[model samples]
Target: MTYSLPRQLSSLLLATSILLWSCESFAPRPPPQRKVIVTGAAGRTGKLVFSSLLKQANFYPMGLVKSEKSAKKIIKDNAECGLENVWICDVTKLDSDNEGSLPNGIRGSDAMIICTSAVPKLRKRHLAKALLKAPINMLAGKKPLDFKTLQFYFAPGQHPEKVDYEGQIAQIDLAKKLGVSHVVLVSSMGGTNPDDFLNTLGKDKDGNGDGDILVWKRKAERYLVESGLQYTIIHPGHLKDTPGGLSELWLDVDDNIMMSPSHHMMSRCDVARLCVASLKVSGGQSSSFDCINIDVPEGTKSRPTEIALIEFLDAETTYDYSTDRKLDYSMNI
Candidate 1:
């Protein structure tokens, strides 16, 4: 009688366990997250992309910076991405001399977002000009964003040849070497016209003006296009530090947006969001287009989504910005 009671109890327990298990949905495990590398993640646009990646469940991004100083500031600004995620990587060093090599910490990355660029600082002479114009602008009921009239120059050793061309080509080769499936490159507008005002900013050792940053940028973009990897190349004009999604984002053919004053400039935040969105859009149409933000100073309720981006890409099937030879208005010297 005692053995019979024990056997009945064991059968009851097994039946209960089986019933509980059967109630489960039996959902399979989710797919693993993708690893993305953001070069120049310490910079304004790069940090936004890096932080945005942290929020997404599908991606794990690592920030590749140029120095410890950059790493610290980015980590401080980004509460979502900590120091652990940032890696010291100077793109200038990853040239032909090193065979397009990269630091080991960034290996096994599935994608790369190239936000690095040769930064231009406003000249002191323009600073005084802006200060003089600010009061007059305010009196005329206009925003004192005198940046259009301002002139800028790059720091030493931070030219287009060094950073835009050689450095970017190196990164692309490295990405290919590391088996990265996708690459998103952020290039600027005015590439078709080498005589644009920005070209005047480039100076030689003896102060001879002969550098055309857009030319170097075009070289890099051409290299990326020929790289044969799935890519999304964005050419944003006159980047502003405004909030994203609040403005109407517009995409158009090169230098065409410049014809419209409202659409000639865009928020950097929106561009960064697009960078993250590009990653989400697997099998996306690989093309180069110009983007800008327009209207809605009071803010818009419509946020940027992958669907809208995909639709735009699908509609503009076979779009290519690499072969445009039309030069727009020349920058007044």
Candidate 2:
């Protein structure tokens, strides 16, 4: 073994340097963690969705709210959990509201779940006069409001069609701009069935009719489909605050009503569960299910369904919008 002393030393040093570099630079990267933005975090559904996301260690959930007050309310339940990553975001005014407004902590978020609805305080009269007046026409580039004495519309009142339609579409646009590829929207079950009691209100021209919420929802759903991002629309039935609530979810396209007595009404927890699960399914199908409650799951606790609903949502390549998708189950009280 004739080894040159200087050459052997140089080789040893080079090998040592390479080994150190490997330790510092060649380590495996952590899995891609999704940063979640949960809009309407102040609402009941948003709250539940936030809680479920928090349970998953990988997801860094950020609660997106309209006001600091709403941000505070969400954190009241479990201070540590709520305060972690709460962003102040109002979709109605996304441009100005979200400036430097993302939650302080967390990064690389995957998508946003919008859970808010029109404020209950804004009734038909206010919606007509304040939201749908001529001034809005100037801002929204729409024609004048076409209704006589907004007061005459009661029970099922008239709503601001343009405002809602535009606002929701704008929000979806903003989400895409933020590089969010997956969005989960919490819509209403009646949205699909225009003739159903729940959806009928939207068709009502006057207050006597069901109202205009459904039209807006339908528009939003279509926009989501065209938004070019992976999306899921969860249309839950009547929302209730029940103890140990567990509901069955049925996935379908069109307006077919399928209610099996075996499945009880769904709980907020289940809805939240489904929302999170949608993200896991491949091809974004797990992210776009049109879900509704009909029956209850008798023995289950407040757990989520393992079956990914997004698959069904994406499978409906056709545009037929008749028949209600039904879920049948009985609630275990």
Candidate 3:
């Protein structure tokens, strides 16, 4: 009786253990973490977005940078907080076999925040001369002053068509191919008008607006909107380096901010936060709007209006280019 009783007890305990194990194994699990890739992640705006993602428990953030050097710098700067992963992908050469290319690791992103833009540099030969004359020209109130005239040009192979248009297109196509569900594009506010003064920054020698960056950026935004993926296009005015929450944020449709005497500026921090928010809202909203950070009093510091920003994800804005008008950029503001 003694041996039989102990054996029966052991058998009963083992059976109960197995039953519990089976139930636990079959229990429902939370959704998998999303791997969100931030292009231009080494830049000021991208850094903030990446940092914010590091704080989020549900999202896994990765960065796609143009060079290994850039990737290293980001890691070094974020030594305390650290990063999950950083991929080196030359967005401009995603389609090229001959140029620096995209890493294969980029194939399965859940969302992409594109902050890459074509950068204009004063033709080195003209850098010194341009630097000397630019301030003088501004001070003199020169009526015909234009930085695009003979001064600046996109570095070889990095023009607007390559970066803003083709680079963005290639990224979008790859993201779509990889089953990405959402995209948040960081673009400019001057695209509503074809003749917007900022387009002059990329003017060709023949005065033809061949390399207009904002035009290319708008084209990329349109492509994302039509790509069937949930998308958010944010056209921020001039970017400021100040803290984000302190500023008053204004959002409008179709370049409405430019209707004022001067385009309002937004902090890189707030734009980054918005980019992160785009992926958090379920079933992303395919919306596009222009936003600017209105300056507030100094020493102002408050938490961001997160609920207001999230509202944008549920309500979409229609971009109407038919209202484009000639914006006079004569103001010093």
Candidate 4:
């Protein structure tokens, strides 16, 4: 004998089965996570980058700090942003000798963003030490005593040549060894020209010129361009402390483009935003460009919508410097 349910009960049972099947078949899947290593993650800019990266559901950011104190602070400050993943490694001291000796923090990293810079106190002492260590005969490379040349030699880890240039090189070497794909370098806007106002600061003072920081930054830029790894070199103008994602961003590849005072400044938060965006745009391809804030006029009838970094990058002409002509001092941007 066949059993028959009441009409109302049978309808309810059939409806429940359909609802369960629909839910099982159409549930959203989580995005794939990608590991990204952030060097100098304890610094002002690095912290913003770390925080911004945390907001992306698919990104797992590992902060690389130079000291245990920094690691502790990062953990304390960003407990919600995966601070337990902070790593300790001095990028300045990373070299071929200790290639395989250090922990494999970079083993599975898909990309790296270098945000390290020498502290002011350390810079002053480092400059003096470099000046005293120079050989009188070869002080200026066969020329008379030129403070700028001395500034370059003594710069490793302490000055622009050392921290910005050499330190970045060490990170690149490690990335290559670990098979990391992309590297995003946070460089200054004046990297292509030593005469730019930003590079001229702290020059020829106390018989110790800082040796155009931009020169060393550009040197590192060139190395990354030639490292055969996908790269994005972001040259942000004078950084300010303003909140990010508020103003419009202006992007240009021409390093010599003369910018007005208002156009020559950007918030560190915005720079960090662009750095993370580059990783997702253009398939993580190599590109270099300058960014600055475009202020909205007060009482304007219509304000421009905040720009998306990926869209801006996609609209610009980005080239692979690795395949371009030999990168020399003459090359701009």
Question: Which prediction has the highest lDDT against the true structure?
Answer: 1
Structural similarity to truth (TM-score) of each candidate: 0.80, 0.65, 0.78, 0.72
- Give the lowest summed-lDDT range of ten residues in model 4: 148-157
By lDDT rank, best first, the candidates go 1, 3, 4, 2
Residues 1-333 of candidate 2: C-alpha lDDT, one tens digit per residue = 675669889999999999999998978878766888887777888888887787787777888777888777777765457456787755555542454643344245678787766532324565557454688776778756543323222222214243345556766776776777788888766555444443333333433532456556766777787778877777766566653234456665443433433332456777887777777664444343445554444665422465535445456544343322221111010
In the range 1-333, model 4's lDDT, one tens digit per residue, is 999999999999999999999998899878777889899898999999987787778888988888989888887887566444787878888874575655565678898899987543334565676656667647556533344533222333476667877888988898887778999999877655446644544455443555456766777888898889998888888789899877778777656434454558889998898888788764855788888888656764322222355665567676333422333443342
Query: lDDT of model 1 at residue 2?
Result: 42
Give the Cα lDDT of each candidate: 0.77, 0.61, 0.74, 0.73
Question: Which ten residues in a row are the worst by lDDT in model 2?
Answer: 324-333
lDDT of 4 at 102: 51
Q: Top model by TM-score, which number?
A: 1
Q: Comparing 1 and 4 by lDDT, which wins?
A: 1
Model 3 lDDT per residue over 42-91, tens place = 87788888878877778777888878798888788765335447887777
Estimate candidate 3's alpha-carbon lDDT, on a 0 to 1 scale.
0.74
Better of 1 and 2 by lDDT: 1
Q: Name the weakest run of 10 consecutive residues (lDDT summed) in model 3.
A: 324-333
Give the Å shift of residue 140 in candidate 4.
39
Model 2 CA lDDT for position 125: 60
Which runs of model 3 end up more than 4 angstroms from their true locations? Answer: 1-31, 80-84, 95-102, 123-150, 204-210, 261-263, 295-305, 313-316, 321-333
